[model samples]
Target chain A: MYEFFHDPIYFLTMIGTVVFALSGAMAAARKELDIFGFIIVGLAPAVGGGTVRDLLLNAEKVFWIEDLNFLYVVIVVAVIAFFQVHRLEGKRYTLLMWADAFGLALFTIMGTQIAMTYDIHPVMVVVMGMITGTFGGMVRDIICNEVPFLLQKEIYALAAIVGSCAYLFFLHLGLDEQGAMVISVAATFIVRGLAIVFGWSLPPYKAGGSPT
Target chain B: MYEFFHDPIYFLTMIGTVVFALSGAMAAARKELDIFGFIIVGLAPAVGGGTVRDLLLNAEKVFWIEDLNFLYVVIVVAVIAFFQVHRLEGKRYTLLMWADAFGLALFTIMGTQIAMTYDIHPVMVVVMGMITGTFGGMVRDIICNEVPFLLQKEIYALAAIVGSCAYLFFLHLGLDEQGAMVISVAATFIVRGLAIVFGWSLPPYKAGGSPT
Candidate 1:
């Protein structure tokens, strides 16, 4: 209990959880899903990434399954978001995007740290970080029958890669875990935020003379 | 090595891999995905479900990652599938559906047996079986930007459930592992095959006369 209270990762994970739940709720509302569907949507973004990460890493029981607090938060937040969908009508897209970016950043650092605990290749660790940060929203998008924003926007995974690398650099430089996490998370959030605001994105790839 | 050759589970799993990879390649061809995307699509249906089951069961490395044979089969079959897409144009849907049902049955029994190997609730084991059987096709559908066929057709998961129950029943009857697997898999595949041929379906859910 004391460790949970003092752990920065735990605290940030909670915030990310809530943010992701809201994102999921927004998608659910847009799809006009039933209560059961709403809850599924909410939970997908909140825990999908971590679940995939744990599975890929062959870690024990998925994080959220082991800790029910995360699902409880998702349920409560989803209920509120579903009821208030009418009020959040116009702002849903913007709100979902921003919250998603924050969740992505937090998870990127947290996931990388967890993967680094194992004796794996650094590149594999970085890919796992990106997967953990981005896969939840991918799950959300897929469930909602929408094209994944990840495929449409490269910045999402790119930010995760950069953030994971930054965290690694700080640790290599002998920075404390908390300090490294803070810096990388903040950097990832800023990059995504600026990209959203400025409409900045990498050019879409096209082979030969292909056009988008 | 000898056990792998003699094991019915291993042989069926290999057939399942090829069939699912072909199903994935068909979906990719329809979507006109690039080579990289095509491989991902093939790999998704071949490995996604086993990965999910391992994650849920908290098992050691997922089945595919632990064995290169599964991947090799998927790739070799997927390439053959991709090249033959033009020839398969008319037969794609029918062939994919049949192959998919076969894969589902094989995975369902295999997954259930594996989960039953552990000390878990019977109900949970059945659920894991359904998940392992259906999730790969779900992944393939999602990656192709289509609503999952599983959600549209309850028979997909239901077939797995029934097959798993059949396997359990046979085991309870003191049938050997090989006999139980054969009976259950054949039953599940036949059920799905009949459903496809007869266009058998459960009515879509609706409440208060609502329709999608």
Candidate 2:
């Protein structure tokens, strides 16, 4: 069990949380939500995964319940994004994709680490990693009235899974926790970033085509 | 454990599922989502709770996965709602409130029963009941780009909690399972219905003059 105040992992988790909050606020800005709505959506992505994780593990309190800093991060990021939106003159789609990719990678590694600490099965850990990485974005997209990218034939969740697998493999090879986290996060970011840059996608499943 | 087929409770659950599907489809119609999107939203409200329950309980498969009839119900309701949108002109708010209340009551009782069968603690069962009752609407509201009513100081979740308390009380008083369920569902429906009709609400929490 990882204690919140004393653990080095807490700082790493906070980084992931802040990044997720920024991405969520960015998404909410695209939807033109009010300040309150933006804050809510931002906090959802920042803390939603950890909330679900704690609930499933039957932990005493949700992460954000214990750490008001996470809430502060979400609120501050949302407030900053509201003002920064006009200054951000770049292509919206490109910025969104990059932010989302970074958030996905960071959250996936953090989720895998937390699940490992709980001593959950490896397969379950991979699933949790994917959930942690993708669910926040899924909620954000749904709240923004867009189709969730995860449901599309994309490499997004697949990249998270691949990175989680890498983490598991490193653990099997007796790598230290911090080393595994660095490698896994890097693997996820590279895989997803390359996929985005190269326009690479999983082959679409063909349905009801004429027999060849 | 309740068996899949031949149980009256199962039949009632199916009815509740269909009603929820109709409510979601009607909401989607108001939101002007396309046919596929409407169907997906409808199915979400219909099966989301059971799916969550199954996942948490580690059940063999999700209910809708094992029973295709639930899917058919959602599809049929969504199709009907889509084609009849123009003709179905009425007080949309009233209709939605009633339908949602019905679904909330039904699912809350069913969820409580299921949790009791698992020998879960009473407090946890109440929480599960509230989750089963309200999460569908929360998801629906999120997908529709609206703030979830649950997050508000609404009578919504309180109705479920009150009903869950009623169910536990009835059980303690030696009521039969069916009698307890009927009372619980009725309690929820009445409370929710009155709340909607009269605009009854919990006072917003005042922490430093802001509802925290």
Candidate 3:
């Protein structure tokens, strides 16, 4: 019998769910949303990326629908985190960034692996990985009415691209799934972490002039 | 033989795709994005809503994947509209609103019918319809760094809800699919069009004391 936690994807996904859900909850709290809104905010970042990825892959079902446990995790995390978020407001931004980085790494690896399961162009697989990593946060930011961090001059998606490409590279080098996933996750986290700590960022794109 | 144009869904969907794609392309052009960026923007609104609905329904593939013509339509519309959009910049917002209203009406009826086919709860079917109608514009607005029109003090989603409920009501009144569809589509278009013309809007939510 394959237990849930024994599966690395499942375990990492659960961890990602909790952290991202908490981040969502915190954002909702800051927005002064009601409980229902907090739950929705939690759910968006928890499962939104995978949902988009599954659609692109033409998968039969989104992961959340396939496994109700993920939904449960989102609800549980939202409730728990919403109550405690006020106390942690001072450090929430920094904490949210780190948690988001972790979630990005995990989701990218899992999405890349799943896309690889179906034979497709290698470039698309890498894109699927990056999409999976960044879209959740993008969805959250959009709903929160903030500028989507991914579209800004952030190194966020670039980090995911690096990790996704590394995953493919390891697979090409004959590394097994678990070995490749570990290396790729670490690579993404380190790069993204250094980006945050060292204020690394891409140059902002400037439209030549305002719209005519 | 089920020829493409024989299906009203196909025809309306194509129209919706083209208009929405043009809207997206015009937005990107105004932003001074490169050709590749314009195409991405075009594709976002062209299929974003249906892609989202398909994901929620756990469909085997998104509608676009089932038909490549949709992708072709997006590309063609993007290119053509990109060149001509500047000429109509004076009336672009009004034209975009009308096109969006038409697309919303068409997509809502079709999406509601499809969700009803899946035998989900009737309310969820209506909700699915509204989701399908408005999400594409929301995605487009988000990508363009504007607040999502759906989330603004706009009657956008409410218009979808009205059409979706009308679809369900007509279905309940023993109107067949074809009958209910046409009526529901007209109802949505009328309501959305009137809202735009009358400048109907909801009161913006105040976050208490105006940003502290």
True contacts recovered per prediction: 0.23, 0.06, 0.16
For each candidate, report its DockQ versus the true two-chain complex.
Answer: 0.15, 0.07, 0.14
Give the winner by lDDT: 2 or 3: 3
Better of 2 and 3 by TM-score: 3
Q: What would the per-residue lDDT of candidate 3 be over residues A110-181, giving only the tens digit for each residue? A: 788877776566777876788788788778877898756665545787788899999999989999878988
Task: Give stretches of model 2 more than 4 Å off.
Answer: A1-47, A50-110, A114-212, B1-7, B204-212
Model 1 TM-score relative to the real fold: 0.60
At residue B135, candidate 1 shows an lDDT of 95
Please give the range of 10 consecutive residues that has the lowest summed lDDT in model 1 chain B.
B1-10
lDDT per residue as tens, model 1, B1-212: 21234666678788988888888877766655544345557888888887888877777666664466776787687666555566655666777788889999998888888888779999888888888899998888887798888899546777888899998999899999889889999988988888888887777868888556
The alpha-carbon RMSD values of the candidates against the true structure, listed in the order shown, are 7.1, 8.9, 7.6
Residue A15 lDDT in candidate 1: 94
List model 2 lDDT by residue over A116-182, tens digit each.
7776788998988888888877766676667877778668989999998998899899998778878
Model 3, B17-96: lDDT tens digits are: 88888878877765665444455578888888888898888776667654667778887886666556666767878888
Each model's lDDT comes to 0.79, 0.76, 0.79
Sort order, DockQ high to low:
1, 3, 2
How does candidate 2 score on lDDT? 0.76
Q: What TM-score does structure 3 among the candidates reach?
A: 0.61
Candidate 3 ranges beyond 4 A from true positions: A1-5, A56-58, A209-212, B1-22, B25-40, B49-60, B63-138, B142-212
